[model samples]
Target: MSPPETDIAVRLSGVHLQFGKTRLRFDCAIGKGQIVAITGASGSGKSTLLNVIAGFETPDAGKVEILGDDVGGRDPAERPVSVIFQEHNLFAHLDVATNIGLGIDPALKLGVKEKAKIASALLRVGLDGFGKRLPPTLSGGERQRVALARALVRRKPILLLDEPFAALDPGLRAGMANLLLDLHRQEGHTILIVTHHPDDVRLLADSVLFLDGGHTLLHEPTAQFLDHSDISAVARFLGR
Candidate 1:
């Protein structure tokens, strides 16, 4: 069952993140249950935007709100968000179940309900019956599946993924994108992903957010962005 369509799930109002000579600014609203794909050149503040939303970095100015509540001051652990990095972020010492369990409780204190949720999440990610494996024992794609499972189990209102399947081969990377589509259909969480994969964006994103030189050049529905050539950023990114 999908969550009810309400107000914006994520809103950044004149937000700014400043490094030595670079400043990333955004003023936008992502509707509830929308999947927005973010793409840009490597240092275009794509990941930094997600980091700011995830509370890893506080913006230099403006409000960051999620689920209609201002959350600029929230800690990473306190925000209504979950994140999956390009790195699977699995602990080498922890087994799959234990690593996933951290989502339920960082202390790994699992009761029956939490264990059940972990199993369900693993099943959702297509990693059923593989809970005993450690990170090193899993393939690159399988490791990403574990990360997805962890994010899903958190049941946060928003989820962010940074180059989620970058390490996988082409076929495997596509498969992970399909899995994400299916999971989003089932869970209905608002999702923002930073990736350079055109196929992933073409196949899954509801909207395309194009960023360049610290500014968002366009935010449009995927089809319009791809079909309309008026946006030079999209054309340049597509090598057209």
Candidate 2:
């Protein structure tokens, strides 16, 4: 059977945010079980928009809703969301197991069940025997995979990625993209990510959102967004 049509995973209405000269206003809704891509130029507030949904930034004038609950003013930890940044936010001093275990228990305390879960998450991300290594010892892509394992273990319904693979080279980036797609298929969570990788949008996103000057320029199905004959704003972005 198909999924419910009314299941709205994220809703933002009349959101307003300003940073001196740059201001953003937005209104949008995303369906459940979708990979939505948020794309824009450098100063277009793409990351800032994700920050708002993830509860890292508060809208000056709007409501933020997730999983059918109004979560305006909620703390990042209090919300049902997980955020992964491009920096791979791993602790250098912590081992892979410790870092991944932090998702379940912040103190790094682990019991038998939690240990099993951590090990499973590790293997799921293709890091079977690397759990004892420190963050600094892992390659750039491995570090990203470790971060993905941590995010997956959170078991949150919504995952927000702010260009999580932006720093990787082309080959490594493609591999990580496939890994992410595999994980997304298994988890079936609602994913909203900020990325410049056209390959990612083509491979994973069901919808594409374009933003500029703190405002939503367009929100359309992935195919429609790409096929439109008059996306001057987007065309210029691609240097076409």
Candidate 3:
């Protein structure tokens, strides 16, 4: 049977954010299970937008919804959202198994069923036997897989990735992108990734969101956006 239609995963209506005197407003809707890439210059507020969705930053004025629930005033954990950042954010003192297991609950007590679930998550990310190793001992790619595994364990339908692969080499980056695509397909998670690389968008994004100076200037399918002359100009500006 075909998969069920995705309810809207994220929606922002008349969203406005202010940092002191400067303000940014934009409207956007991200479909469920779609991989949307947010791209722009350094100060374009791509990260800010993701933060707003993840409830890390509240918009000054607007409605924010995730999975059809009004999440405007919800805490980050209260929203059905997961975020992976550039820093990896793994606990240096914990073993990989403990780290991934913490995704389910940071309290660290798990029943047999929960332990099995954590093991399955590790296997899904190709880290089955590496669970006992420390995060400091793993390669960059391996560490990232652990991070992805954490997101998987959270079982949230909405995911926000903030330059999660920015520090990897070209080959590793490609691998991580492919891994993300695989996870998105398997889990049917709605994802919004903050990135500056056009090639990354081309490889993994179903839709593109271009932000310029804190405003969303373009939002369309990846192919359609790439074909637009104005978007191409912006892509050129980013050296894509």
Candidate 3 per-residue lDDT, tens place, 130-231, comes to 888999999999999999999998999888999999999999999999888888789998899999888888898988888887898888898887776656
Q: Write the per-residue lDDT of candidate 2 for residues 21-71, one digit (tens) a residue.
A: 877898888889889999978888899889999888888898988987999
Whole-model Cα lDDT of every candidate shown, in order: 0.88, 0.88, 0.86
> How close to the true structure is residue 9 of candidate 2, measured as C-alpha lDDT?
91
In model 2, the Cα lDDT at residue 31 comes to 86
Give each model a TM-score: 0.95, 0.96, 0.94
Task: Score residue 215 of candidate 2 by CA lDDT.
Answer: 88
Please give the range of 10 consecutive residues that has the lowest summed lDDT in model 3.
1-10
Candidate 1 wrongly placed segments (more than 4 Å): 1-6
For model 2, the local distance difference test gives 0.88
List runs of model 2 lying over 4 Å from the truth: 1-5
Candidates in descending TM-score order:
2, 1, 3
In model 3, the clashing pairs are none
